[model samples]
Target: MVITDVNEYRLELARKMGVTRAVNVAKENLNDVMAELGMTEGFDVGLEMSGAPPAFRTMLDTMNHGGRIAMLGIPPSDMSIDWTKVIFKGLFIKGIYGREMFENLVQDGGADSVWPRSLADHYPSFLYR
Candidate 1:
């Protein structure tokens, strides 16, 4: 898997963890780096760990069609995303908050969280629910 970060230390950690490709966004061009790494169609799944607005946007821009994204970090107070692309490309974005919220709930309770149940009951089209 490819890990993208601005910190050298984190890149090194990712590399040590078996990620052969890591992008230091502060120093290299992301598209060029991905291209050099032979990724033409972009990633199939993206784990948005940084929660930086730019990182989130980049993930949205670079994911393949029908891409799924799980976010772990806290979002910026003033974040903005392109909803048009999300709808057209059939992107699925799920927010994973800290212990008190969804991700932990889903993980610990196996889709028993109120959010998933609500979605499943109300919006049958959303299969993720």
Candidate 2:
């Protein structure tokens, strides 16, 4: 997996975490770094952990056709993104909220329960332990 950050030291940390490539956006272009990995076609899945709008856009710009993205970050200020890419690439974007997860877990009566069918199906052990 490729990990991108604004910190060089953070990139080193990513390298230690079994990431195939770590990009320091402070020093390199993400697309250029991705190209160096022989993946000009882009990534299939992107997890937007940072709430920065640019990070979200970066994920969108670096995804391949039929790529999917899940975002945990909600930026303070709205930023414009290239809608053309979303339409042309057929990318799927989703927002994640921890409250919803907790609600589903509680309503479902533990991880073993099946009330929230989608959650249990996608992640059986998310709230199991």
- lDDT (C-alpha, whole model) for all candidates: 0.75, 0.75
Clashing pairs in 1: none
Model 2 residue 47 CA deviation (Å) reads: 0.7
Q: Provide the global lDDT of candidate 1 against the true structure.
A: 0.75
**lDDT tens digits, residues 31-98, model 2?**
78777878759898787878888888888888999998877667776568899989999998888866
TM-score of 2: 0.69
Candidate 1's C-alpha runs over 4 A off are 97-129
Find the candidate with the highest TM-score and give its number.
1
Error of 2 at 105 (Å): 18
Q: What is the lDDT of residue 105 in candidate 2?
A: 54
